[model samples]
Target: MDLSLSTRTEGERTVVVVGGEIDVYTAPKLREQLIDLVSSGQYHLVVDMEGVEFLDSTGLGVLVGGLKRVRAHEGSLRLVCTQERILKIFRITGLTKVFPIHASVEEAVAATD
Candidate 1:
């Protein structure tokens, strides 16, 4: 699937709904959107990845960079990922310890520091 992204504010959190593959080719798009949001002073992001069909190392790098950027501003970045395949990548790479992953967007948005 082709990459797609849409953002909406939910209370104080920005929900970014992502669809399609996130690989070397599409990772830059995700990275740019994230940088724009953070640079614009809109942090508290919840990335809903339910529609994501595939994610590669490049995508993981982008997410890690996003986390660093948010942390620099004392902000937070959460994720919503229900796919076992995707979740397994996080586990294998030890990113499960780095990010707060929820099964639903609502749950991820509700999580607080």
Candidate 2:
């Protein structure tokens, strides 16, 4: 399936609502969006993945890259994903330690410090 990405502001965070599948073909779209957001000076990001139907290693890499981009500006990249299937990828890759995953956008946004 195709990927869908939308961005909005909540408090001090820019919430990127992601839906559909994130595979090799679609991961780059996400990566570009993240880069644009960060380059535009919006660093505190909360990626809401509740609508994600599937995720692959490329998607994980994009997330990690985004995290790094934000961190370079002393910013943060948080995730909102409660899907067990998608969460398993992070767990398996030990990214659970690298990123803060939240159950909801509200929780993720509030988690920004």
Candidate 3:
């Protein structure tokens, strides 16, 4: 499954809409996008993962990296993961407690406020 990523502004926050599988091969794309966003001073991010089908350890790592990147700059990184499979992965890995997971992009974007 190929990964597709699109980013846009939602008020003051940036929303990254992701689709398809997020494995080792596709995780780098996500990582680079996050890096680009953070590097350019766009720290408030909402990763809308509802369209994501499969997520692996590498994907989780990228999310964690993004979280750290934003936190280091006193910025915020939130996730919109309504899928049970993806939510389960975060819960099992104890990441649900680390990342702010929301039901929708609007909610996630509002959370930064």
**Residue lDDT tens for model 3, 40-76:** 9998999999999999999999999999999998888
| Whole-model Cα lDDT of every candidate shown, in order | 0.95, 0.95, 0.93
Candidate 2 colliding pairs: none
- lDDT-sorted candidate list, best first: 2, 1, 3
Question: Alpha carbon lDDT of residue 7, candidate 1?
Answer: 98
- Model 1 TM-score is 0.98
Q: Write the per-residue lDDT of candidate 2 for residues 53-95, one digit (tens) a residue.
A: 9999999999999999999999999999989999999999999
Residue pairs in candidate 1 whose N, alpha carbon or C atoms collide under 3 angstroms: none
How does residue 50 of candidate 2 score in lDDT?
96
**Counted clashes in each candidate structure:** 0, 0, 0
Model 3 TM: 0.97
Q: Local error of candidate 3 at 85, Å? A: 0.9
Instruction: State the displacement of the C-alpha of residue 2, model 2, in Å, after optimal TM-score superposition.
Output: 0.6
1 against 3, candidate with superior TM-score: 1
Specify the poorest-scoring 10-residue window by lDDT in model 1.
104-113
lDDT of 1 by residue, 3-96 (tens): 9999999999999999999999999999999999999998799999999999998999999999999999999999999999999999999999
